[model samples]
Target: MIYNLTYNGIIKVSREHLSNKLEVGFNTISTAFKYMEQSKLFILSRNRSGKTNCGYRVILDMQHVNFESILSEVYHLKAYEIAIVKDEFKQPNKYQDLAQNAYISTLNGSNSTLNYNNQI
Candidate 1:
């Protein structure tokens, strides 16, 4: 269902929505999403400064990582003719938060403006 509903690699799927659609528990949908994320089959949207909705991007075309080409070829989009989707983490982000959070202790009690010079 998600594959059929997806548009331009972007899909707005929620745990509850999937649960209702698939006739399964919400937790089941959540676990399935987690497994897909770990396997790099989906990219869940991270909370941004102003984004208020919960959504995700589905990577249906595993053979192509360059999403711009999908727009050009499938959607017939021109480079200068439109605005692009503002995807923060365009690729798989399964362990991105884990790695960043693991090093947060080093940033505490220090001026964040100063450079650590790739120490983390």
Candidate 2:
């Protein structure tokens, strides 16, 4: 969902909708969003004004060329290279020699979990 949302250059997200889609609790989604925001992967517009969210802007993925033009036109967002982050988060190789395991680089931020955006 995150990948698709970012790739599509759509930034708005709702805890309720994400909760339903991911079959998780609203609080769980909220917590995840909080973590992402803290990690700088997303910029959240937090609201304590009763169960309503103001949505968020996902950290733009510059390596994903498909979204650049769309994002510029839609949100006037110019995505800058995140400096070695995008390449480090790509999916694992589909075909690797069984004898040699390629290390899949993990996404590291100030305080974040292992990023598996490739799968999401």
Pick the TM-score winner: 1
**Model 2 off-target regions past 4 Å?**
46-120
Off by over 4 Å in 1: 5-7, 46-66, 69-120
How much is 55 displaced in model 2, in angstroms?
A: 6.2
Candidate 1: tens digits of C-alpha lDDT, residues 8-118: 464445666678878999778777767666655444544323566555433343323455666476557687532443243255566655544543333566644433233
lDDT of each: 0.52, 0.51
Which window of 10 residues has the lowest lDDT sum in candidate 1? 81-90
- Residue 20 lDDT (model 2): 79
Q: Please report the TM-score between candidate 1 and the true structure.
A: 0.40
Each model's total of backbone clashes: 0, 0
lDDT of 2 by residue, 10-108 (tens): 456567777778899988876776655445443344334445644443444333455446545655554554323344445343333331443345356
